[model samples]
Target: MQKYLPLFPLNLVVYPMEALNLHIFEPRYRTLINECLDNGTTFGIPAFINGKLPGFGTEVKVTALSKKYEDGRMDIKTEGIRVFRILDFQNPMALKPYAGGLLEMLPMPEVRPFVMVGLVERVKTLYRFIDEENTFDVNKPQPYSYQIAHKIGLTLEEEYQLLKMPTEAERQGYLIQNLERIINTLQEIERTKERISMNGHFKNLDPLNF
Candidate 1:
């Protein structure tokens, strides 16, 4: 079925089962939120890569909302409900910051449990590395898709490819491939570090007295 949705173009791709928190300060998006709350409508979070919104996005349900200021600013939490292909966009006028769109929901595959678990584990490994290197907290509840997607550091383009995949298995395969690449890169870094340490030890050796 086809329907129109309020569109929120963002720099990140949101996957189904992922939760996103957004600060709503722009007037256009504020209006969009109000409309959704009033009418029980879903919104499209089209991925904006390199400053352009992609043709496909996910439909999001507003799960929570709180007023942040007297000037209409809000703090909101949303979860992805389904994927959507944008058919058309109503461009923003001079005063509005958001766009509206016509969209159609894409079909989703019934993902097998094992596949999901594999993807989740791959993501966990990646996050562990990130936490160790960057001091990022590791105890937060992981979002099913974010773990897989964030681990490989997928570019916006690569993320779009995953979103366009027709089956859950295909998406998992793509993630696995990326994860393998990440693992290889980490191994290479470790090897280089070890070689550097050995070189330092050789330099520290006592000078030969001839």
Candidate 2:
């Protein structure tokens, strides 16, 4: 179904179920947040890359107002709900400080089990290589590709592409390919570092020390 939503264009991509914390300093956004909080509505954060708003974005609902300053600035926490594609954008909507757009919801398909399992393992492996504390929960009834997207060193554009994917299997496949490339690059870098660290080593010099 087509619907209209308040627009909050941001330079970041937020995937469904991802948490985002934002500081509202601008008067327009402050008002927007206040209205959403009052009405219990959601706002769209369309991807703003290279000064252009991407057609696709996530709808987010405020979860908490962590801080409210005396000056009216706010620190808010939000969680992404779903992806929406903008059918038409209205800048400065009806003389309001914020923009509005017509959006079409993009529903996600049930995650394919085999694909999700493979991707989860790949993600865990990538995290291990980087020595990161793995917090991925693969046992969830429905695992999402976004759970590992940010952790796998995906570029903003790549994340957006993953967001645009229509099905869970496709997203999982994209992540697997990306992780493979990233792991290979990381391995090459580590090898180069090991070679560089031994640049001045000499067997004859080591024998004298011994």
Against the true structure, whose TM-score is highest? 2
Model 2 agreement with the true structure over 1-210: per-residue lDDT tens digits: 788999999998998778899999999999999999999999999999888987999999999999999999999999988899999999888868899999998884354244456776777778778898987675543446877777789999999998899877788888889988988998899899999998988745544554
TM-score, cand. 1 vs. native: 0.80
TM-score of each: 0.80, 0.89
Overall lDDT per candidate, in order of appearance = 0.74, 0.85
Scored by lDDT, the top model is 2
Query: Where does candidate 2 clash, by residue pair?
Result: none
Please write out the lDDT profile of model 1 over residues 1-210, one tens digit for every residue.
Answer: 788777889888888767789999888889989888888888889988887776888999898885567999999889887788888888772345678788888875343223456665666677676664433222334333433565468877898888777666677788888887887787788899888888745365687899
